[model samples]
Target: MQCMLRKQAQLWEGAVLTTVGASKLPKRPKVLVWIPEIGDEAIVRIRIRKQNPDLATGDWLLLSRKTDEMRQTLALSTDKKSLRFLE
Candidate 1:
């Protein structure tokens, strides 16, 4: 018989991201961006007063954490919901 071990996954910081999306609400969806990256899907939490409303399915954006000053490039989401990662 053979035995295998599983490895733990790394965790990311969560933030209150503000962006625009396709929804019926006046304000954007309140989403928790844990590991936002280029080409990843995300939801909006605040209304972008001056941001463009012309977003596509593969559009990207820069996201940042509240504790860190570094901003990460992430994929914008048309679906209004929280962001999550898969194993």
Candidate 2:
């Protein structure tokens, strides 16, 4: 049941028709995805090395429940892989 909850807790943002937010390529060569609605007062930011995410400003993404808890300058889930990208 715990596993099921994990799957169910995943939060997918945006759709093919609607985009959540666009990715930002920092000068430090990192991909940062920032979302504010689902997170606390501060925005939720996910970081990835380089442009591996290959995401743009209007790309949608899925964030794990764990990710939300560790928001505010966090780089997404670290306990387990919990992000899903739209194809």
Candidate 3:
């Protein structure tokens, strides 16, 4: 599912709330993101490359699938707001 990062909240561990847009409804479903270590690695690389310590909000993430409770993050928006994925 495709979702847009809305906000990040710290509750016990870091949690990101995203707005899921899959239908035309007044209420958009909000889900807590379960980011894995692999995804975190990419995020860290982006931060280091851009030299921005802060996490980027409003970024888009495309999740491909889930396996054993781990969601596979397929693609992510760069600091320049461009999409990039593993080829």
Candidate 4:
């Protein structure tokens, strides 16, 4: 699958929703999704891009084409293809 590095709005100021597991505290880094879908609120194993700092093992994310501005806060799962990288 394709992965893009984008930002999502957050309820708290100065705090962006970088991943599925970003907290208000600054100590914690943002996270990315490994799978294409998050069934529950549990953390799942994922292969995130090295260039993205906000993406961690358990952070939330919004994935899609750059053209679409809509951001959906959800977890993801891998596709049938072995390839699991995002642009």
What would the per-residue lDDT of candidate 2 be over residues 1-87, giving only the tens digit for each residue? Answer: 889656655745442233354454222222234444346322232333233444332232334333454343323322212223312
Residue lDDT tens for model 4, 2-73: 233222333456664344556553442232333444333333333343444344434433342122233324
Q: TM-score, each model?
A: 0.19, 0.17, 0.21, 0.19
Question: How does residue 76 of candidate 1 score in lDDT?
Answer: 36
Model 1 spans with C-alpha error above 4 angstroms: 1-25, 36-64, 67-87
Instruction: Please tell me which predicted candidate would have the highest lDDT against the true structure.
Output: 3
Q: Which regions of candidate 3 fall more than 4 Å away from where they truly are? A: 1-53, 70-74, 81-87
lDDT of 1: 0.34
Candidate 4 structure, TM-score to reference:
0.19
Please list the residue runs of candidate 2 whose C-alpha ends up more than 4 Å from where it truly belongs after superposition. 1-42, 45-55, 67-87
User: Can you tell me which runs of candidate 4 are displaced by over 4 Å?
Assistant: 1-26, 43-87
- CA shift of 17, model 1, Å: 28
